[model samples]
Target: MLLQLISHSLGWLSAQVSAKAQDALIAVLSSGPVPQHVAFILDGNRRYARSKNMQIKEGHTDGFYTLRKMLEVCIHMNVRCVTAYTFSIENFKRSPAEVDALMDLAEEKLLELCQKGDILDKYGIKLVVVGHRDMLPERVKAAAEKAEEMTKNNDRAIFNLCMPYTSRDEIATAVQSTIHERLDEDADDTVTADDIEAHLMTSLSGSPPLDILVRTSGVKRLSDYLLWQCSEDTQLQFSSTYWPEFGMWDFVPIILDYQRKVWSKA
Candidate 1:
């Protein structure tokens, strides 16, 4: 019911009458102290594929296109950093064929983002892969490395793709890095939480932690997402639509609603 209202309201917004492409939405987005870093839990690809009786790879393909669209929107909206959950550490525990297909998709998408990625390049998006890279296949690593290098000069936004990442693994890696940093510097036992955060490879070291986190598939749980960054004032919005079907419309209203809560809505 609520989504219907939002959909109807936005449906009437055509390009001719559209004021600044999302003037109202952008007004709301700008009103608030905007989210510097936002993360996404992209889920329900397999389920969506099954509902359509299509191959899982087909569903992943759709999801990939959705990601491309949203990244473009994020660039336009000026979201500083956006992270998408691509794969988990335990995903390897799935059936061999399914796991292999997922790996192939990841590898393919990595290559796409690297060599022929005009959209990302056009928007000055820097690609950063977050997760246990050591666990990834050599080919995937090469693709990710290539993307990072290809987009290194671009700085309009940070696109962090999480592959083989899990909250438990992130914590363990943080601990290991903290220990290594202190020992490497020959520092005594006076290391604090701030020191550990500084050693973190991603933007968790920023002054303001994650401001908004979006999880699709109507899933309420964070489920091992952003263990260190989501502190107080963190906003969470869930979309029942699968990640493949999610678009800026899904995100725009939610941010507008949130903006109303944090600041005056336009």
Candidate 2:
């Protein structure tokens, strides 16, 4: 009982310190060039699980929790749009068991997104799952659709879940959609860059292109996420920490660095 009490007290104290630090950081950096849209390439779940000798599901669960925390932080920081690479189309190549687990997690998370106290309604954040719905499991796809419907009227912030998504696939689909729409209208057959952008799956947010794209776990490459949406001016920040270990406090420093370094240059 005494040990538990001590642990609880310490946790409370830590949270207090964290809260104060976060507020200070925000006060200083909020007036700076905050990202209008931020996207995350969440990596290192499996590696983290392996390192800890824990079940892969646990790592992914932690990653999801991190994502929730991230959204709250971004909203507080006044970021307009947030996109996450939840499940890539290429993830289908993983072991059947792992893929099944991911699908189950997605279905569960989507349901959670609609519940009270989950922040969707609290913050008026709209949720959109952009991907190939036909390729997803029925239950998962249904949950995503329901979540989108529930939050369709929200306008405060846009949250995009890139499930079963790939930049290459999205680009190709945009091209096809643009062409088909042009044909249906009996208009010009030429497909311009604007035409493709108009039909992009992720562009539903109607926000500016990504101003900041972060890939955690030390990976430098985009791994096929937001390939076209990240403009040349977008600041790409790579973190050494795993997604599960990333927090709003950790993110503040990166953004501050970007302001001092990248934004100044631009």
Candidate 3:
């Protein structure tokens, strides 16, 4: 029995060392290329909170700070745009208390950004939000509007916050806009994909297609985010680490892998 127990302990230790070695290998092997616009699903907040026996509100609070730090790395890497899926349209299905908490947190963060926060004022980063705003509360909408107004002139970087969004809704909204924009043309003229893309609510100035998308917590699903934007050229990297737990170490390696992938295929 003693020998067996010792054997099991050794096996566990070996596995842990192997896992670290693999991460290091991934870091070393993947390097040198970064994406122009990187979008993140920002999933697993509730799970993270629950696992730690914390309230759902804490999850959003933690996520907000995590996103801010990621943006700093994005700016350091010279990424032109970073689109984050903040609140999905389907997220309303969650409990009302949780939903309300999210809305409050988001509004507060937006207000902070609009108030000339450290990052926004110092770096001159432009803040933008997309998705169904009409469904949002007045205060939330006002916060978004205020942020947009304050950052309308700044051009250093784009912080696209997707609120109450989904690919289906975005596609439908873009289609409607196309019809409105091209009213003079015959409806039967047959609109192409580009025409539809031109109308999507992603913002006017250079909302280019995302090159690399990463989702955390080991989940491998789009969850109705960024449908039309991710083309064949896009690369996705998934991690088991939760979003709140995600750090620059995770981001730096992923960017390096992206750069290598882009250049290798060229």
Candidate 4:
């Protein structure tokens, strides 16, 4: 009984410490230039799994927990929009078993989010899946559609899941859409870059130009992600940590560095 009491006491203390740390970060970020729309390239899951001698599927599952934690921090920071690179179109090249596992996990997680969508409700966050939905499994697409429908009325925040997406493909699709729209008009209409962007997958959220993009696993390259959205002032932070290891606290130094180097100058 004494040991049990001590364990409980320690847990309580740890929780308090975590809460205080989060509050401190939020207070500091609130005073500075906070990113309106932040994008994350969720990488390094396989490496993390390899390190632990775990299956690739287990690594992806761990990454989902990190995403939940990230969402909590973003909500606390009052970020207007957050985009996660959930899956890339190139991922279809993986082994069939691996691809199947990933698709199953994605479907499971989406349905779980729908059932427990109070997290979105708590923050009044609109959840939207931006990608080639037609290529997704029927059940996965159905879940995504339901999640979007359920959160359609929300306005405080927007969470975008870029599933089966690639920046190059997105840009190409946008261009095709713009041209198609122009062709629909009887008169010869000029199509501008802005018109193409308006048709982009990212445009669904009405999300502003990506203010900051974080890629984990020490990757410095964009890897065909968000090529068009990256502005001159957009701050890019490459984190050495694996996606499964990313946490709310890890965001502090990155944001602070951006403030010192980019936002302060702006």
Most lDDT-accurate candidate: 2
What stretches of model 1 exceed 4 Å from their correct place?
1-33, 204-208, 264-266
In TM-score terms, candidate 4 sits at: 0.95
Give the per-residue lDDT digits (tens) of candidate 4, residues 54-117: 9999999999889878987887887899999999989989999998999999888887776654
Better of 2 and 4 by lDDT: 2
Q: Which pairs clash in the backbone of model 4?
A: none
- Clashes (candidate 4): 0
TM-score result, candidate 3: 0.85
| TM agreement with the true structure for every prediction | 0.85, 0.94, 0.85, 0.95
Backbone atom clashes (below 3 Å) for every candidate: 0, 0, 2, 0
Candidate 3 weakest ten by summed lDDT:
25-34
Q: Model 3 segments beyond 4 Å from truth? A: 1-32, 184-188, 203-205
Ranking by lDDT: 2, 4, 3, 1
Which pairs of residues have clashing backbones in candidate 1?
A: none
TM-score of 1: 0.85
| lDDT: the better of candidates 1 and 2 | 2
In model 2, the clashing pairs are none
How many angstroms is residue 191 displaced in model 1 relative to the true structure, after the best TM-score fit?
Answer: 2.8
